[model samples]
Target: MGVLLDSFGPALWLVLSPTNLVIMVLGIIAGTILGALPGFGAAQALALMFPFTFGMTPEAGVLFFIAIYAAAEYGGSIPAILIRTPGTSAAAITVLDGYPMARAGKASRALKISLYTGVVGSIASSFIFLFAASGLAWIGLQFGPSEMFAVGIFGLSVIGSFFGDSPVKGFVATGIGLFLAMIGSSGFSGLRFTFGQASLLDGMPLIVVIIGFLAMPEVFRLMAARRGDDPEVASLGGENREANHVGLKVMRKLVPTMVRSTLIGTAVGAIPGPGATVSSLLAYSEEKRFSKHPEKFGTGIDEGVAAPETANNAVVAGSLIPSLALGVPGSGAIAILLGLLISKGIVPGPLLFQQNGPLVMAVFAGLIVSAVLMLVVGIAGVRVFALVARVPRYMLAPFVLMLLVIGTYAYHNYAAHIVIAILIGAFAYWLETIRVPVIPIVLAFVMAPIIEANLNRAMVIHGGDLSFALTRPITLIILGLAVLSIVLGFFRARRARHESAAAKENLGETP
Candidate 1:
């Protein structure tokens, strides 16, 4: 504790240096713009900017990535609110209420809420990173293969059934995703499903899957839909000036939601593996469950926008906890940052503080500073971002398609990825046409490798005895939580379906 406190002053000096500050601001600006574009999320942004960090000092490079990482979380909400297109999968929850709020002539209000709550969540998370990263990382270290497998199962339960009315379709989608993840070489087997292509040897990249299933479908919809100018854009032109201001009364009402979501985000983020998306989904569900007007969650409510935005931004700093303290990358972007640290010959582990306290502290300081800068830049650029909604759908579709192609190709400079993305995008579009949820597929794909490898190792350790999980307390607890999550998700989906049926009947539509 004394060492951490002592390093704070030097950390501040390092972060506030002129070169670092410039890198911070530049990274934030670039991140915001790229994040506002569908298909170009934080991971993609970091991957694109990776080469630029080669010439920078380690502290400056870390600070630069931190700035972009935090700002992208805030920037993703911009498109989600104004156009119903989430720039990142984590921002998908924001679309449920953010777009509806914009339709109610309060686009500016929603943007302000997202900006403010995101800043609050990020700041709180930074403090957690500064004070408890090592402690949290130590807790993480206690998990063995079985515990991690159970954790992966718990994550699946939290996300799998939340989408689509039919649980069967969700299950099928998840099965397909797991199957996709199983392609590529295995330690026990030479090769399982990599036909003749060398590219499939590594399996499908998550970036390709994300772009195809999530972003490209939006592009297809934009190209196909024949809507006029958006109401959000018109509202921006003539809405009341005060609509942009989130006053004290509104802030007070949102305090509890922000607090709850911050805790959820930070805790989940420290666990590793799809933390941002999972945290946002969990926070949104929790807020809806806790609200007196639970049924009104997707109907342009302030809390809906606040919950997920806050959680996703909080994930930025929380994700760094494991990366800095345990040498474990919590997400794809953090993996890139971890690579940077390794390239710089900075090892992160139990002895990291003793060996590299100053640099780690600088990163801690940079997280908070970048969060504040995100708020500033987000507010200043809101008007310009809203202009995206005003672009003709015809023009917007091709531009977004161009971005999808470029981003996919840029991921590994592989042409095959572009073709695969287009194919998967078309398939995903067809799945949406049948009302099957894609969220389950994405969550399942991301978790499958972790679950498989961990389960395999656990089995090997226990001599293939499955009963050992019941004897391990932590594994039992996590599996219990997974079962509970599954039950809750089932009920939630059932209630939502019933409400949809009732609403349709009230409007004289067929069931």
Candidate 2:
């Protein structure tokens, strides 16, 4: 206890420094702006900023990125509510009801609810981080290659469960992502895929692929669908002011949703790959299931805003578990962070905790501070940001596309990457039109390599006995859970279909 307290004290002091606080504020502001803009995402922001961190200490750089990540999640709600355009993929769930509320002139109220719920959820999840991180670290240290592979499989399965209404589409996205991930050189034999191009030798850059799939295509879509009209922002004056004012009563009402979503977010975040989008969607669905008036969900209820906002923010803390402990990135942002850590000579594995205990503790402290800072910044700037929603898509779209191009090229000074980003963006937009969820693809891209590497290692060690994956008790338990998740999802889908059929039957009878 004494040693732990001593370690924590210095970490708290490091983050409490005025310089660090200022950086946190700047990161949150910058991230919020990027998140509010269309075609910009947290991953791109991190990739762009990653080079700048080369000069800073690992602790400071990591903290800066965490600040951006946390703020971006909250910032996404701005565009989601105001324009029906999600600033981040995770914010897509917010648009289901948030845009409706905004159209009804309750944009201010929706923004306030999102801000408050995000803060509460972040704080709640940080506590989970504080308590669970060390234990998870200890457990992760014992995982063999086979166990890790199983964990990766479990993560991929979770993605299938969390994506859109069609499980087949989710699996298809995952398969494509995994196939794309295999494009680079094979880790074992040094053989290359789609051989012949020098650029293909190093395999596709994760940044390039992510940017292509997520950012570039959105730019073209925005341009093609360009509308001159601006969205209306709810003013803070008169009745809107009264409605927007967040009070104790509102907080109390939202508390249940916040708590539930936070729990769901933490659990999903703790998983290996699905990250915030899955967590937010799961939380949103759960909220709908539990709501007294489920019909109001997509009509812009505060509960709708609160549930997803809270879950997304909570995911920030949860993602850190695997990254900090086992060197596995829980999400895209964490993957970037892992790369940054590697560049800084900080290898993140079990040894990380032993060698960099103080630094690890410092990061944990910084995460807590970032959460608090998000709340402060979010509340103070809510009105101004809400108004940013009124910016015309015509103007915003071009600026976002330019930023995407610049950020992509700036990463490796490669113009090819910019082209790649454009191609990916165009493809992603088409995929969206076809109702394919991007989350599974993104997650599969992130996890497939890890899974392949670990599985190959495990097989070599066990003389090709694949059963080693289940030989370990913990791995078996995880696999069990994965199977259970599939079963549950199947039943849930069936129940939803039955409910829809019954509703139609009742309507027919009434007519």
With candidate 2 superimposed using the best TM-score fit, by how many Å does residue 39's alpha carbon deviate from the native?
9.0
Per-residue lDDT of model 2, residues 1-511, tens digit only: 2344457878889888888888777888888887765545688678767776777777788888888888888887887786555667788678777877876667778888888888888778877776677665455456667777776787677667646566678778888889888886786777556567666666667656655675555566556654644333223122456766779999998888998999888877776656677677678867876887765766778898999899999888887877877887877789998898888899998787677777777777877888788878877887776665555556567776776677567667877667666766777888988998765776677678878888888889999888886678978987887787666656666777798899999999995
* Candidate 2 TM-score to native: 0.74
Candidate 1 per-residue lDDT, tens place, 1-511, comes to 6798799889999898888888999999988887877667788789889999999988988999998888888888887887666778788778878888876667788988999999999999889877787677877677788988898888777666555656667777888788888888774567778898888998888768877777777788778756664444455434566765688899999999999999889987887665788788889878987998876877899999999999999988888888878888888889988888888888877688888888888987998888878878887887776566556556678887887788788778999999988888899999989988776777688778888888888999999998868989999999999899778877877887898889888889644
Question: Residue 147 of model 1: what lDDT?
Answer: 88
**Alpha-carbon TM-score of each model against the true structure:** 0.88, 0.74
Clashes of each: 0, 5
Segments in model 2 whose C-alpha atoms lie over 4 Å from true places: 6-20, 27-114, 129-134, 188-203, 206-221, 224-247, 260-365
Which ranges in model 1 have alpha carbons more than 4 Å from their true place? Answer: 37-39, 82-85, 100-106, 184-201, 227-245, 493-511
Cα-lDDT of candidate 2? 0.75
- Residue pairs with colliding backbones in model 1 are none
